[model samples]
Target: MVKMFLDFVGDKFSASNPIPVPDNDPLDDCSAISHGTHVAGIIAANAIGISQPGFIPDVPFLGVAPEATLGAC
Candidate 1:
């Protein structure tokens, strides 16, 4: 589902104004891109219960409910 959504967004947006693919090593020279920062901001900014994309990257701040039970599929 996530991949499909991303693909759709990429196809739609790329057709008009292409967004460059994220470099494999975005942090090698951090200043070269804002993708990392943008992702971090989104994850940290989510207030609702939705597990938005980039909602938790590292082990630190995992979201608003770090202790909530996450059931298996």
Candidate 2:
């Protein structure tokens, strides 16, 4: 499901790839992808995960939106 969502975003949003810097570190690429991917993962992970809100059952995980839904301001 997460892969589907990422693919959908990749397809629908036709944006240029980040500029190709010479001798770029793989960590840089991971970091760049992580920035957005982490946000998306947090939002949809639980719903797609096995236990939902009860997954943690102890520790409090911060959600993508602890206040309101994410939408255009």
Give me the runs in candidate 1 sitting further than 4 Å from their true place: 1-27, 46-73
- Encode model 2's per-residue lDDT on 5-40: one tens digit a residue: 112122222346544333322222234345666675
Residue 30 in candidate 2, Cα distance off native in Å: 5.4
Model 1 TM: 0.23
Give candidate 2 regions above 4 Å deviation: 1-33, 47-55, 58-73
- Residue-level lDDT for 32 in candidate 1: 48
TM-score of each: 0.23, 0.24
Show the colliding residue pairs in model 2. none
Error of 2 at 57 (Å): 2.7
Among these predicted structures, which one has the highest lDDT?
Answer: 1
User: In candidate 1, what are the lDDT values of residues 1-73, reduced to their tens digit?
Assistant: 1111122222223446776554333223344467755654544444544454765733344454444433211
